[model samples]
Target: MLVLIGGAAGTIAFDLFGRAISPILGFASLNPIGLARGFLGTLGLPNSGAYGHLMHLLFVGLLAYPIGWLFVARPVFSRVLVGLHWAFASAAYGVGLWVFAIGGIAWFAGNPAFLGFAPIAWVALVAHVLYSVVTAATINYIERLQHAR
Candidate 1:
């Protein structure tokens, strides 16, 4: 549960940061946020709108908190949850990579000069990977706390 909550929180936090920085950095309005909406919609989930995006973030956070509590509340589930966390994290990373590649290619094709965005992409990718790692570590630590309790 900690894993889920952490995952959701991580997702929301990243989205918020991405939305805030995208325009400042001259990224397309549809870059990260649009990618998220499209991916969620593809999975038949609700897409985040300007207003609803905040709600969705809260929703994910709420769902994750309880799951975290559950895992923390039960010792036996800790290991299983941790394993699941890594599995999901891996999958999410893969999806993120796919989205980045597709979006980057499309953007570059339309604006050949957009290769200037390469440094931005590189920086963003590094930050993203770091975020994922931290989220995974947080989940793991939370699980350990649950087990220790």
Candidate 2:
């Protein structure tokens, strides 16, 4: 749920920070919605906008769930065992997300040449990191609560 909320925030931020002002800022466009629309086909919709947004949300949840489970939530107590801070681990996971997902797969799968030259790529990377942070925090909270019960 937190991951979804963060994704919504990221989507809004992306549009607000996107190509509308690219003329003033040489690289300001990451169109996940556009990418979804192109990749997923029309889905019987007029322009595929709504379908794309839904798929984008699902993708966000799918991406964050495992990271939250495997990295942050799972290792929170283990960090204490190793004398490390949980936040440090979570942050590392966030950056790892950027390095692997946006920088690697999305770049290669989408337009490597264009992504390398775009500021939106960086913004999208941050968005993914933010999403991961929220997922980590939320899952940690839930785990704590479950234990408290």
Candidate 3:
């Protein structure tokens, strides 16, 4: 439950920052919807902007990422580096996510790998780290609240 809440909050923050703040700050805008459409193309599927939006928002943002944080990242990191602060751990996880999604997955999605190491890539790195930190912070806060009861 906490993980879901955290993940949702984190996704919202990521979307908001990428869509609203980054462009206003003169950073390249993230086009997650277009990315999703490209991913579908890689799979030889017809592009549907609506489906792309749904997949990005519902599947990736709302479900897969949070579950990944809870089941994969937290468990492995906890045992490997005991007593590590959640913020640091989450930031590391965000870097990993950036590598997997931007560095690796970009190739399959027909984009230059690592966005050719461009400024947008840096912005993406920042966005990913922001997402992860927010997610972890939200989860930790909720857990503390529950324990305080």
- Which prediction has the highest TM-score against the true structure? 3
Evaluation by TM-score, superior candidate among 1 and 3: 3
- In candidate 2, stretches whose alpha carbon ends up further than 4 angstroms from where it belongs are 1-30, 37-47, 62-81
Which digits, one per residue and each the tens of the lDDT, describe model 3 over residues 1-149? 77679888998888888888999999888877887788888998776998888878877777787788878998889999999988899999999888987887777898999889988888888888888889888988998999999
lDDT (Cα, 0-100) at 11 in candidate 1: 62
TM-score of each: 0.43, 0.59, 0.94
**Per-residue lDDT tens digits of candidate 2, residues 49-115?**
7877776656644444444545564466465557655555655666776666556555454556336
Ranking by TM-score: 3, 2, 1
Q: What CA RMSD would you report for each candidate? A: 8.4, 5.5, 1.2
lDDT of 1 by residue, 1-149 (tens): 56565666566545554555654776633254444354456556676675245433444333533243334423433455665555355435534643453445335334333235565455445445544544555666776898999
Which 10-residue window of candidate 1 scores lowest in summed lDDT? 106-115
The residue ranges of model 1 lying beyond 4 angstroms of the native Cα positions read 16-30, 37-117
TM-score of 2: 0.59
Distance from true location, Cα of 103 in model 2, Å: 1.9
Off by over 4 Å in 3: none
